[model samples]
Target chain A: MTSSRPRPATIGDIARRAGVSTAAVSYVLNDAPGGARIPEETRERVRAAADEMGYVPGAGARSLRTGARDLVLYVRSDAAQGPLASEFLHGLSRALRGLGYTLMQYGAERDRGLEAARAWAALRPAAVLADDDRLTRAGVELLAKGGVPVVGLGSDPERARGTGLSTLVMDHRAIGRAAGRHLAGRGYRDLAAVLPAGPPLRAMGGERVEGVREAAAEAGAAVRVHDMAYSPESAAEVVAGWREEGLPRGVFGYNDEFSGLLLGALLDAGVRVPEEVGLVGADDLVLCRMLRPALSSVRMDGESSSATALRIAEVIAGGAEVHLSPWTPVPVRRAT
Target chain B: MTSSRPRPATIGDIARRAGVSTAAVSYVLNDAPGGARIPEETRERVRAAADEMGYVPGAGARSLRTGARDLVLYVRSDAAQGPLASEFLHGLSRALRGLGYTLMQYGAERDRGLEAARAWAALRPAAVLADDDRLTRAGVELLAKGGVPVVGLGSDPERARGTGLSTLVMDHRAIGRAAGRHLAGRGYRDLAAVLPAGPPLRAMGGERVEGVREAAAEAGAAVRVHDMAYSPESAAEVVAGWREEGLPRGVFGYNDEFSGLLLGALLDAGVRVPEEVGLVGADDLVLCRMLRPALSSVRMDGESSSATALRIAEVIAGGAEVHLSPWTPVPVRRAT
Candidate 1:
C-alpha cells in the first residue's frame, strides 16, 4: 500500500553517529532486553546520538519487518440509527483520535451477520472491539479461525477464545443501580424510568429500569415505567400526558439526551425540578452545565472510543490478544 | 471475501425474480428519466417485487459496475471550522442517516489540503463535501480529476471550485447583520461579540464581526470586539473582568456553546439576562430552550451533514450536482 519513497536515514545513521553498530541502536530503542550483549555505555551513546540527530524509525517499516504494528480495531455492528447515539460516537471518535489510530465502523448490514464475518475475515484486523456483544458465536469463530484477536465491548468476554472473541461486558444493571441509589437518596418516594423504543436502547434501558425498580422496591418506594420515542416531540407528548397518566415524583431518564428533552418539557409546563419532579440525566456534556438550574446526571468516563480503536489496530497489526478494562457510570451531583 | 454463507440478493436477484435482465432492473430504478421508455405495467410489477422481496441494492456492486453509488462524502477538514459548526454536522448526520448513507468525518492529518485529497481518493467516495473552500485549488482539482463529484458545505463554492465543485455557502454575515440590528433596536448602544480563540473560527468570526459592525455603524451605535477562549474558565474570566473593563451593553456570543457557557457564568456572578446585560447566541439547540429566561439566539440550520452525504451519493449515482439551500438564522425571542 506504500509507494517507494527513497533514501530516508535508517538506524545506520544513528549507529554511525554513536560510533556503534546498528544492532546496538535497535536493542536500545526496542528495549529488547538481552537481545544484544552491548555494554551500557554503548547503549547510552546510541540513545544520545539518536536524540541529537532526531533519528526516528518508521512504523510502516517496522511493521513490514515484524509483521506487527501497534494498531487497534474498534469493530462495531452497522448503525441502524437516526442521529441517536451520536454523543457516544462523537465521544468515542474524539477519544480514539486522541489515542492515534484509524477507526472504522463496520456492520454486517441487515441480517447478514455471516457476510459481516466474511468482510471481517478479509480485513484481518489484529484485534476486534465489538461495541455490541450480540455478535453470533459463528461470527466470532470466523475471525478467530483467521487467527485474528478479538475483544467484545459490552459483550460476553467468556466466549473469546471459543469463538476467538474476548468480551468486556458493560454492566447495564449497574447504571440502573446508580440511578436508583441517587433518586431514592433524594427522598422522592414515587419513581419511574422513561425508556426509548429500540432494540439496543431497550436492553440497556431495561437493565437501568430494573435497577431502579429493584432499589425502589426494596425501599418500599412506588415505581412506574414509561416508554418514549427518542425525539423532542415524543418526549414533550410523554411529559405533557404524565400528570394525567401518573407522574412520578422522581424519574430516571435512560440517558442524558433523553433526560434533557424530558426535563425541557417538564419545565415548559412550569413544573418545578426536585420539587414537583426530580430529574437525572447521563453524559456530562457542556450543555448539561449550561442548563438553567443545571441537570443532575450520571458520569461515564474512561478510555474513549479512539483508545479502543488504537488497541484494535494493534491487535490487527501485531496479532496479539488483549484483556480489557471498562469505564462504568458514576453519579455526578448537580441541580435536579 | 464472502464465506460459504449465501450472499444476499443483488440486482441480479431482482432481475431474475422479475424474469428480466439486470439492465432492466437498473433502467427501472434509475428511471434514466427521458433515456428509457419502458411500459408502466412492467415498471409497477418490478417495483412491487422489489418492495415485497425487501431488496435494497448493494452499494459496493453498484459502485463497481456503474462507477457510482448513492453515497455522498462530507469531508470535515482539519483546517477550517466555524462557530457551532457541529450543530450543522449533527443536523446533517440525522438528515442523511434518514436517507441511508454513512456520514464519514474526514479528518485531514498534518498533511493539510492534499491529505484530504489522498484520504478521499482511497475511500473511492461517490462525491466530496469539502467544508474548507480554502484548500489549495490543486487539491480540489485532484478530487475532480478522480471523477468524484464535489459539493461545498458552508464554503464559498464559486471560489473553491471556480468551475467544478458546487457551493453551499451559509452566509453567516447575514446572521451577524440580523443580530446587530436586533440589539440596536432594543436600545443597546454598545455591542460586543465574544469570539472563540482558534484559526478555524477566525475567518467566520471576522465576517460576523464585520456584519455586526456594519449594522452598528449604520445605526450610529458603538460596537466593540472581544476575543477569548471558548472554555468555561476562560469565558468566565472574560465576563468577570467585564465590570472593571466597561462591559458592552449587548454581547453576541460566537455560537451556542460559547454563548451558553458565558451565559452560565454571567448568571452565576449575579449578572441579569436582558436586564443588566442583553445576550444572544447562534445555532439553536435543545439546550437553548431549556435555559431559564430562555436564550434569544439565531438558528442557522445550514446543510445537514448526513443530507450532504446523501446528495453526494446521488451525484455518484449519476444525479445532477446538488444545489444546497443555506439555512437562515432566525431570532428565537424568548426571555432574553
Candidate 2:
C-alpha cells in the first residue's frame, strides 16, 4: 500500500476547482463581512466544490485571524468527575453549544496558577471556566491580559474583585450550615464534620467545618472536626475511633460518596444509625436513594447551566462587576 | 476601570525588547535548526527578554504552519465514564504526554459518521480514537484523506481492514462466554443474559447474548436473553417477571453498574441469590465488594493503557496491520 494520501482541501483547492480566486472562495466559505457583494452563482459554485472535496474550515487559521477560538476552556479540578459535577458539565456543554461556543474540558488539574494560564493562553480560547481555588490572582490576570475572560466557581468571590474575573461563589459554608442545622433540628447536641485531609480539598473543607462550628454555637452545642483520606479503610478507622471515643450524636461527611463509605463502615461495625447516630452528606447523588437506609444530603440549588452560560456570554461581551452566589445549599432529608 | 487590557506578548514584542530582528527571535524561541550557531550571549539576552515579557508560543500559529496539532483526539462514548474506562483514560493521558502528545477528549457522542469526522478534522488532530461502533467507513476515509489516522476500539476489527484504520477489538461476546461458562460449571442448565434495551447499548448486548448462547449449546444447556432499561424500576419489573414465569437457573447483567442495580432489586424482591439463581456481572467494580453477599462479577484482563498507548504511538509512526484484542473477560467468584 502506498503511504501517499490526499491532503485536506484548502481554500486554494476549492478556488481552483470552482474557477475563482482564493479570496472569493474564502469570502464564500467564511462568510466574511463583504461576502454579500459576491454573486450567488459564484458562491454556489464554491460551496459545491468544497462539498465535493470534503473541505473543513481550519480552526487554527481562523484563530490566527481573529486572535481567539470560539472555544470555552474548562480547566477541570480533581473532583469535577463526581455525579453532580458531571451533570453541570453536560448541561454547560449543551448551553455553550447553543450560544455558538464549544466547551473544551482540560484534564490537567495539577497545572495550577500562571503555568496553567500560559498553557490555556496558547489555545487562545474566548473564555475559561474553573472551579474551586485552582486559579490564583496572577493566573487570572495572565489570562485577562491574553484577551480571555474568566468565570470562577469557588468560596471566595472577593479574590477577583479587581482582576476583572467573574465569580460564582459555591458557598461551601452554606452547605455545611444546612447539614449542621438539619442535625441540630433532630435534637443532636454534639456534632462532627468529616472532611478530606488532602491539600487540594482542604480549603473548601475548612470553610465547611467553620459553618458547622457556627451552627453548633447557635444551637448551644459542641462540634468536632475530623479529617481522613478518601478510602474505605480510612472511613472504617474513623468509625472505629468514634466507637472508642464516644460517637457524636450527628456527623456529616464532606460529600455523598465519602459519607456512603462511612455509612457502610458504621454498619459493618454494628452501629445503629439514626437511633444512636444521625448521618448527613452534601451534593445529593443518586446513590443516596439506593443506599439501604437512604442517606440524607444537602442539595446545591444553583442556577441552571443555561443561566450560567448566559452570564459567561455577558462577561465576554464586556460586562464586568459580576458576582453570583449561584448555589444555595439546602437540606434534603432521607432515612439517614 | 479602563476596558483596555494588555494583549498577550507576541514574538514581535520580544524581538523589539531584546534589540534583535524578528527572524533572530524566532530562531531563539522556536529552536529552529541552525539556532546552535548563534552566540550564547545573544541567546541568553533573548531568553531573558522573553521571560520578562511572559511570551508563550501560540498553538494556533504553530498548528497553521505545520498543518497539524500535537493533539490526539478521543471522541468519548456514553460509557466512557465507567470506573474501568476512567482508569484507561487517565493512564492513556499520562502515556501520551510522555510521548510528547496531548490527549483531548471530545464529548460530542451524538455526532457520528462523516459529520463527526468533519468536526474533528477542523481541529487538525494528529490522530483520533473512538470506542464501539461510532464511526462509519466514510468517516474513517475522510479522516485518512486529511492525514489523520484513526484507532478504534469495538467488536469488528475487520470493518477497518482496508481503510487504513487501526482497531482494538473489545469482544463483548467473550465477556458473555465467560459468564456462561461460569454458570455452566456451577451445573446451571438454564441461564440468562440481561442487557440494556436502549439502541446505543443494543449492539454490544446482541454480541454478548450470542456468546452466551454458544456457551450454553456447548454445555448442553439453554440460554435466554432479556433487555431492561437503566433504572431501578425497570430492574424491579424484570425481576418481578422472573417470579411470575419460572426463573432462569443463572443470570448476568451486561456490566457491573447494571448488574449491581439488578442485585439490589433482587435482594429487595426476596430472591435467594446463588441458591435459587446464580448471578454474574462484568467490569468488576468496587461496588461488588461493598454490596451485601458480595456480588460476583467478571474482570476484563486487558493490557494496560500504557501498552495501548505504545501501540497507538506505533500506528502514528507508520506501522500498519494492527489487530489487538485487549480484553479477556474472566469470572471473579464472590458470595453471590
Cα lDDT listed for each candidate: 0.65, 0.79
Off by over 4 Å in 2: A1-55, A66-68, A78-80, A131-134, A153-155, A319-321, B1-55, B64-68, B77-80, B131-134, B247-249, B274-277, B319-321
Worst 10 residues of 1 chain B by lDDT: B1-10
Every model's TM-score on chain B? 0.71, 0.89
TM-score of model 1 (CA atoms): 0.67
C-alpha displacement of A281 in model 1, angstroms? Answer: 1.8
* Residue pairs of candidate 2 with colliding backbone atoms: none
TM-score of 2: 0.86
Please give each candidate's TM-score.
Answer: 0.67, 0.86
* Highest TM-score scorer: 2
RMSD per model, one decimal: 12.9, 4.0
